[model samples]
Target: MGFIIKLLLTGAAAMLAAYVLPGVSIDGFLTALILALVLAVLNAIVRPILVFLTIPVTILTLGLFLLVINAVIILLADYLIAGFAVDGFIWALLFSLVLSVITAILDMIF
Candidate 1:
């Protein structure tokens, strides 16, 4: 299914992020897959609500607050997933940004 494909792509992106970012790490392929699934669920259920609630700040920051939201989601995932780790807030932000770029590229290529 399309969802499965996206999930796999996201897992791949997570692994890619681990490789490219020093402060981000995934323990294994399975952990990456799990992280990807959790991230998808959180983004679907939590991210929209956060975005809606932060609209004022988002507008004030010219939409940059969305990146912070993405980082928060990543940090939440890091907290929930034992095998996934982000060094700190800065690493979370960079990881989120890199993961987005990697996933977008994967989406395009696949």
Candidate 2:
């Protein structure tokens, strides 16, 4: 199904981020897959609420605040997932950015 493809792509992106970013660590492909699934769920359920709550600041920052939201989501995932780790806020931000870019590229390619 399409969802499975997306999940695999997201896992690939997470693994790619782990490879490129020193501060982002994923224990293995299975951990990356789990992280991807958790991130998808959080983004679907929690992200919209956070985005709605931060609308004022998000508008003031001209949408850049979404990066912070993404980072927070990553941090939350790191906290919940034992095999996934983000060193700090900066690392989370970078990992989120890299993951986004990689996923976007994969989406486009496939």
Top candidate on lDDT is 2
TM-score of 1: 0.97
Candidate 2 global TM-score: 0.98
Off by over 4 Å in 2: none
Q: Which tens-of-lDDT digit does each residue in 1-110 have in candidate 2? A: 99999999999999998999999899999999999899999999999999999999999999999999999999999999999989999999999999999999999999
Task: Estimate the Cα RMSD of every predicted model relative to the unseen true structure.
Answer: 0.7, 0.6
* Number of backbone clashes in candidate 1: 0
Highest-TM-score candidate? 2
**Would you list the C-alpha lDDT of every candidate in the order shown?**
0.95, 0.96
TM-score of each model, in listed order: 0.97, 0.98
